[model samples]
Structure formats: structure tokens, C-alpha cells
Target chain A: MPMTTAEKILAAHCGRDEVRPGEIVMADLDLALANDITAPLAIEEFRRSGAVKVRDPRRIVFVCDHFTPNKDIRSAEQVRLIRDFSREQGIENFFDVGEMGIEHALLPEKGLVLPGDLVIGADSHTCTYGALGAFATGVGSTDLAGAMLSGRAWFKVPVSMLFNYRGRPGEWTGGKDFILHTIGRIGVSGALYAAMEFAGPAIHALSMDDRFSMANMSIEAGAKTGIFPVDEKVEEYVRGRSGRRGRSFPADEGAEYAARFDFDVSGLEPQVALPSLPSNVRPVGEVKGVRVDQVVIGSCTNGRLEDLRAAARVLQGRKVARGVRVIIFPATQRIYLEAMREGLLEIFIEAGAAVSTPTCGPCLGGHMGILAEGERAVATTNRNFVGRMGHPRSEVYLAGPYVAAASAVAGEIIHPARVAGGDRPGEEN
Target chain B: MKIQGRAWKFGDDVDTDAIIAARYLNPTDPAELGACLMEDIRPGFACEDVRGGIIVAGANFGCGSSREHAPVAIRGAGVRAVVAESFARIFFRNAFNTGLPIFESADAAKGIVEGDEIEIDASEGLIRNLSRNETYRSQPVPPFMRELIASGGLLSYMMKNLNQEGKKK
Candidate 1:
């Protein structure tokens, strides 16, 4: 039987020749992950289950990204518990402060997740690994515990949805804009419980960084996960990262899909998901002039090296507008070092943006750059949910790095062409 | 199994963040987590105030994030069950794994008004709005899921089957 990429991956993990959507199966995991905030709860569950040893210590990882640097005593206690648990269980992949990046970024960079792998995490953005053609999805902490104890987790095999993205992308627009536009069109529940297979000439052509950005937001569209068909870009990215030769699964031609949608990006504009919901999006032209109190340029979604370059390109010589607080996170320490080597860090600091150690800070409103009540921010972070960055009334606008940095200079949401020097993009200044 | 409660209304896409904000996640205690349920979007509407209430919402309830805290907070707040037009996938799983009852019935979500008395049966997939003298059908909860709920959650379920070998050794 023909199967989609997700179905093929799930079937292989479950030791079945074929699996269909809605057939519940306990699938083996290539990697099971949790961060500081979630691992503590999962650890409690693991202990309560009378599981003395993890099924495979090396296969389970705990990344201390969420409130590390230990924002508060409570957060410190949580990390301390996980650290103790990791040592007790002989877990080898635990990462702590200075040695850690965001879990979603750190795992892929270390090649901990690979194509055709089945990964689960306590974090929603776990689906970010689908960029590598893996079958990965997020679950609650107890589900993380189940994977820890047995090396397997249950899944309701989801049907697939194919999104055909074609045409050249507009300037200052990339994967973030593509995904934001998609969410706006489909609403937050667009894909519901379906695997969103992103395939098309244009999707396959996107850089790995852009692909990561797109896959990272799969949850915002309520997708089981967003995946790109493995191509040369994926093979090249994985070649030097992991020594393991992971299996690859390709959807058979004419494999079933629940639905298919086509998008034309030739004239697509940079998109900004407005306050409170990622689905509430508009082109940069439609929502310009919304002044921001702060600007954030980093997260699991848009804090990669290329995202930094895009932000630095916009902030190269221009200063961040006075009275506007700008903060930049480099996604990972390795990415931070690479940004420094490329002098992107200098451009960011020279523009008056506060550079911080990589953490999920302010993305979940954890710490580092929280907004005051009534304040508004333009963030490259994936979410813009209510009270996501501190005060309930404070607002966050979700955008790609280019628009985020451009808005930082303009002190209001505006097109990148407005700051990309002399009247570029053919927009009247 | 059946649950009855007053109905609390919410619009579409009630994300995990709205169910329980990140600020409240620092403390994992169910009681502490539940105190502030839905605090971000509707401040001062304490979850404690809606004890035993059925949250009836538009489509896509419990969207965003895989934070189990969302469902944990819901059960902690004493919410009996949730009847929505639909639920985001992970949230649906989390709700069941945590033994929190949830139903998907668009008619119940739309027909049941705020503070209306409502009841739901997991085994039967029926939702009754006593205030309006009307009933609606929800998607049936699978047998395996009902088993998880019956055992008080996945943790208890895992104990019986997962650790038996280790215990024997």
C-alpha cells in the first residue's frame, strides 16, 4: 500500500509493513526529549511508574532551555531536579546552561534527530524536526515519561495534507512569511490533526534555515507536523552532523492525502501575525505604523544563523530607534559564535540591541525581556498568544527577522524596503 | 462515564497559553496551576470560580503548545469536561492522558449558553443541554482512551504494563 511520508515513518517505527491514519500504534522513538520546565514533571511521572532505568539512556535527552540561567528559585529547583535525574539515570545527552541552546535548535544542530526518525518531546515545537524528513510531534510530559520508560509512545496515525508552495518569494519574505500567510489563510486549526506535507518546487528550494523556520511553526497551524520531502538540501545538512545512516521514507507517487492546497508566493508580501493569534496576519503594507515598545529577534523559530544575518543586514549601520528596546537571541551558543565570527553580532550590538545567551527567554515570557502591561513588541518568535510575553494586555506581533529588525529601526511595523536604503522593492518612500 | 456542570463560554482557538500562561508554569502543582487558569486572556476570571463548570467553546479549543499544564490546570480547576466544536490534536491527547473529559459537539458548543447546565457521557458520546432541553452527539472516545481515563491517567496505566519486568528482576 502507498503511504505518505508520515505514514511510512510511523509504520516502520511500529514494526508494521503498513499503517493507516486513525490506527493507534505504539511507535518506537529515535529520540525522546524534554526541557527544564517539562522534564521535572516527566521525571516525577517516570519515578512514579516504578521505572528504575530509562529504556535507553542515550536516546533520551533533557535540554535546560526554558528558564535557564535560572530565572527564579522555582526554575532553579526544576533544573536541579532534572540534573539529578539525568545523573541517576545515566542519561548522556543532558545539556545545561552555557552548554545548552533551545531544545528544538540544539537537537537538530547536534544531529540528534535525523531523517526517517521518530522523535517526541514535551515541547510543542518538537515538530521542528520534520524539516529533516523525520516523524516528530509534541506531547505532554506524561507522554514523554511513557517514551522514557519504554522507548515507545502512542500515536493516532494522522492522515496527510499537502501544501504546494510555488513561485519566487518576495524580498524580506522567506519561510516565516510563507508559514504566517498559510496560517492566516487556513486559520489556526487549518490542518487540525493531519500531517502537513510541504512539497513543491519552491518548498524544496528553501534554505535549511528557512525550512527550519517553517517547520518550527507547524503547531501554530494546529498541524500534527509540517514536513518537507527529503532533498539534496536535507541530505547536505545531515551529512556532516550525524554519523548514523538513518533510513529515508518517501511518499509513493499518488499516496493518499486528506486535502491539497496550492499557494503562489511570486507576489507574496512579508506577513505579520497581529496581536494574540498567529492566524491573525496581514501583509506589511496593510498593518504598517503600529508602533512597538520593544523588538525581539530570536526564538526556536527564527534565531538561526541565517535569521541573524537577515536581521544584521537590516541593522548594519542604522541605529535602533531611540526609546525602542531591542533584544536579540542567537538560538544557540554555536550559532552565537558563528554570528560573532561573521560580525553579525557586532551589527546587532552596534544598533543598540541587547544580546543575550540563547534561551527560550521572552518567547514564552520566561525571562530576559518581558514586556510591561500595555506594551507592544515585534518578535520573530513563533507565538503571539495572549500574555505570551508578560502582561496579559501587552501585545506581540509575529514576523520574520527582516521585518522584525526593520520595524526596530522604524520604531513601528513597516516594510523592510523602507530601511533597505534607497527606495528598494519599488515602494514609494 | 458521565459529568455534569454549568457551561462556560469561550471563543475559538483557546490556546494552551490562554488556558495557563507561561508565567504560571514555573510551579507544577495542580492547585497552584489551576488557580490562574485562563488568567491571561480573561483576567480575574479565576478557574476556582468555575469549579465543575463545563467549558463550551467554538472550534479549535486548546490550541498551541504541548504544555500538559493546560489540561492539568483544567482538571485542577475542577472543570468537569469540555465540549467544543473541535480540539487541537495534542490537547486532545493530553486531556485524555490526564483523564480530563472532553467532548466534540458543534451543536452543544453553539447551543449551550454561558452558565447553562450541561452533561456529557464519554462512553455514549452524548451531550445534554438541560437549560435548553436539547442534546447533541460528540465524537466517540476510543476504547483505549477511555481505558486511560478510567485508570486515572497514563502514569497509572504505565505502571501495570511497563515496569513489570523491572520489578521481577
Candidate 2:
């Protein structure tokens, strides 16, 4: 039987040759992850399950990215809870402060999850791995706990949607613009209970980092996951990280799809999602003059090394505007080191932006650079929900790295094209 | 299961952040989590006559983040059930896992007004507005998942299944 990539991956993991959408299958997981905030509750359920030992210690992973380095007393306790459970269980992948990066980014970077794998996590952005051709989705804490005991979890296979990208994006527009435009076209719940498959030449043209950004925000579109089919680019990335590239599951020819969309992104402009909703998207030209108090350039969505390079390109020879506070967070410690070595960190610091140690700070209002009440920010992070970054009255505008960096320099939401890229050189960060 | 409560109405795409802000996610006590329920969206929402209430919201309720905190806070606040036109994926599963009954019915979501006395018969998928004298039916939980809800999600199943496997080993 013909199957979509997601369906085929799930089917293979379940020891079946074929599976259909909406059919429940119990599939083995290549990996399962939980962060500090989620692990504590999952641990509680793990103990309540009356199981003293996990099904596979090697497969269970814990990362202390949220509230890492001990944000507060309770946050400290949350990490300690997971740390102790991991130690006792002999789980090999417990990532503490110095070793910790955002779990989704860290996992792919370390080659812990490979192509065509089936993965799950207690956090929603687990769908980020789908960028690498893996089948992944978020599960509740209880489901995580159940998977810990059984090494398997039930899944209701999702119908797949094919989003065929036909043309390349314009300058200053990339995968982030594509996804923001998609969400704007389709509401927040547009892909609810569906797998989003991106293909065609334009999708292949995107860098792996760009693909990661697109897949990371799939949850914002209400998708179970978003995936790009494996190709030479995928093989190259996996081969660079690990000798073994695992396996690849490509959708069969004439595979079934619930719906299909063709997006020609070559003419697309830089997009920004306005305050309070990721779906409230408009061209950068639409809301150009709205002044912002802060600018954040980081998160699992766009916090890769390439994101830093993009921001650095826009920040070179341009100082951050007088009153705007700019903060940049590299997604992982390795990315931090790479940025430091490449002078990206120096450029940001010279530009008046604080380059913090890798953490998810300020993105989920966890810490580091929270916005005050009545404040507005332009951020490269994923969601812009009301009060997401800080005070309920504070606002966040979601944009790509180029636009966010340009906004920092302009002190307002503006197109990168509107601001000269460091034409006047002197003390430009 | 029959749950009786007054209706609390909300608009569409009511995200998890609006349901419970990230700042209030800590300290894991149910009551503590409930204390600031929807405080971002409506100040003093927890202070309202919300106990024993059913939440009726427009389409795409619980649209962002798979934070189980969203449903936990609502269930902890003593909200009996949620009736929505539709729901985002993870929150729907989180609701069942946490034993917080949620239903999908465009009719119930649109017709039920705020503060209306409502009763939900979940097994039969019936939602009736006592104050408005109207009735609506929600899509029933899938057959296999019904067994999950009956066990209050994973508490019984995981506990029993793992324990039995332990003894066998």
C-alpha cells in the first residue's frame, strides 16, 4: 500500500508494512525527551506507574534548557528532580547547565535522532526534528510517562498535507517568511491533526538551517508535525554529524494526501506576525514604523549558527538604535562557541546587543531579557501570543533574523531593505 | 458522565499562554496553578464564580503550545468540562490524559451563552444548556481512547500494566 512519509515511518516502527491515517499503532520510539519543566511531572507519573526501572535507559533523554542554571528555587528543584531520576535510571543523555542546549537543537546536532526515526517528547516543539525527515510529535506528560515504561506509545496516524513550494524566496525572505505566510493564509489551526509535507524545488533550495526553522514552527500552524523529504542535502547533513545516516522513508509515488498547496515564494516579501498571534501576519512593509522597545534574536525556531550569521550580516557596521535593547541567544553551547570564534558575538556586542549564554531565555518569558509592561519587541522566536515574552500588556512581533536585526537598528519594525546594510561604517554592532 | 456547571465563554484561538501565562507555570500545585487561570486574558478570572463551571469557547481553542498546564489549570480550577467548536491537537490529547473532559461541538460553542447552566453527558456526547433550553451533541471520543478516558488516562493503565510486567519478570 502507498503511504505518506509520516505514515510509512510510523508503520515501520510499529512492525507493520502499512498503516492508514487515523489507525492507531503502537510504535517504538527512537528517542523520547523531556525538559526541566516537563520532566518533573513525567517523573511523578513514572514513579506512579509502579515501575522502578525504565524500559530503555539509553533511549530516554533529559535536557535542562528551560530555567537552566537554576532560574529560581522551584526551577532548581525541577532540574534536580530530573537529574536525580536520570542518574538513578542510568540515562546517558542527561544534559546539565554547561552541557545543555535547547533539547531539539542539541539532539539533532549530536545526531541522537536520525532520518526516518520516530521520536516524541513532552514538549510541543518536538516537531522540530521533522525537518530531518524524522516522524516526531508532542505528547502529554502522561503519554511520556507511558512511553517510558513501555518503550512504545499509541499514535493515531495523521492525514498528510502536501505543501509544494515552486519558486525561491526574494532577498531578506527565507523559510521563516514561507511558514509565516502559510500560517497567515491558513489560520492558527489550519493543519490541525495533519502532517505537513514540504517538497518541490524551492523546499530543496532551503538550507538545512532554514528547513529547521520551517519545521520548528509547524506546531504554530496546529500541525502534528512538518517534514521535508530526505535528499542529498539531508544525507550530507547526517553524514557530516554521524557516520551512520540511519534510514530514509520517502512517500511512495501516488501516495494519498488530504489536501495540497502550491506556494511560489520568489515574490514574497519579509513577513512579520504582529502582536498576540503567529497567524496575524503581514508584509514587513505593512507595519514598518511601529517602534519597538526591545529586539530578541534567538530560539529553537531561528537560533542556529546560520541565524547568527544572518543577524551578523545585518548588524555589521550598524549600531542598535539609541533606546532599543537588543539581546541574542545562540541555541546551543556549540553554536555559542562557533559564533564567538566567527566574530558574530563581537559584532553583536559592538552593536549594543547582549550575547547571552545559550538558553531559551526571554522566548517563553523564562528569564534573561523579559519585556516590561506596555513594551513592544521584534523577535525571531516562534510564538507571539499575548504576554508570551513578559507582561500581559507587553507585545511581541515575530520576524525573521534579517527583519529582527534591522528592527533593532531602526528601533521600529521595518524591512531590512529599507535600512542600508552598514553602508555607513563605524561602531556598527 | 454528567457534569453540571455555568458556562464561561471565550473567543476563538484562545492559546495556551492566554489560558495560563508562563510566569505562573511553577509550583505545580493544582490550586496554585488555578489561582491565576486566564489572568492574562481576564484579570481575576480565577476569582470569578468559576467553580463548577463549564467553559464554552469558539473554534480552535487551546491552539498554541502543548503545555499540559493549560488543561491542568482549568481542571484544577474546578471547571467541569470544556465544550469547543474544535480544539488544537496536543491540548485535546492532554485533556484526555489529564482526565479533563473536552468536547467538540460547533452548536454548543456558538449557542451556549456565558453564565448559562450547562450539563454534559460525556459518554453519550450530549451537551445541554439548561438556561437556554437548548441541546447539542459533541463528537464522541474514539472507541480505543474511550478506554483511556475510563482509566482517567494513564494512571491505572500504566500502573497496572507495568506492575504486572514487573511480577512476570
Which one is best on DockQ?
1
Fnat per candidate, as a fraction, reads 0.81, 0.74
Fraction of native Cα-Cα interface contacts (under 8 Å, chains A and B) also present in model 2: 0.74
lDDT, residue A127, model 2: 93
Docking class of 1: medium
Taking all chains together, each candidate's TM-score versus the true structure is 0.97, 0.97
lDDT of 1 by residue, B25-138 (tens): 888888888898898778776645698788899999989889989999988888878889999989998888877788988888888899888878767889988888998999
List model 1 lDDT by residue over A1-429, tens digit each.
Answer: 799999999999999999999888878899999998889889988888777888899899999998989999999999999999999889989999988998898999999999999999999999999999998899999999988888888899998999999999866789999999999999889899989999888898799999999999988889988887888889988998987876779899889999999999987889999988999999888995699999999899999999999999999999999989999999899999999999999999999999999999899998999999999999999999889998988999999999999999999998898888533553453
After TM-score superposition, what is the CA distance of residue A43 in candidate 1 from its true location, in Å? Answer: 0.9
Candidate 2: Cα lDDT at B110: 87
Q: Can you give the DockQ of every candidate in the order shown?
A: 0.77, 0.74
Q: Which segments of candidate 2 are over 4 A away from where they belong? A: A243-245, A421-429, B159-169
Native A-B contact fraction in model 1: 0.81
